[model samples]
Target: MIKFNYPDGSHCYRALHTAHAVFRNDDGKLIARAEKADRTGMYEFEITGFELLSTGIVYD
Candidate 1:
């Protein structure tokens, strides 16, 4: 498994799984990180839950 640091500043990601996050940069480039939740299994959250509330899809 490849490991990476989360991007700088605030960020949003597509949750592929409990341990994976897919992030798209401003340039439209994409990357996947290895971890999403901490040891307690809490999520870091994405898109402020607004889009998730309006639609089932997540946005970046």
Candidate 2:
């Protein structure tokens, strides 16, 4: 797994079951990661409740 810091200066992690996050929404409410196979495949994310939000990537 990899680590990343959000726009709000908060920290979060990439989903082990999914791919590493490569893109995120402006409001930090959504995320989009690269696929393990092609690194350009589709990514899915669902934001709910008080889950951590991400706007951009800080590190890999």
Per-residue CA lDDT of model 1 for 1-60, tens digit only, reads 222334454544334344445566575555543443554544432222211222454433
RMSD per model, one decimal: 11.8, 9.9
| lDDT (Cα, 0-100) at 50 in candidate 2 | 23
lDDT of 2: 0.50
Task: Quote the lDDT for 22 in model 2.
Answer: 48
User: TM-scores across all candidates?
Assistant: 0.25, 0.30
**Residue 44 displacement in candidate 1 (angstroms):** 15
Q: What lDDT score is found at residue 29 in candidate 1?
A: 54
lDDT of each: 0.39, 0.50
TM-score, cand. 1 vs. native: 0.25
TM-score leader = 2
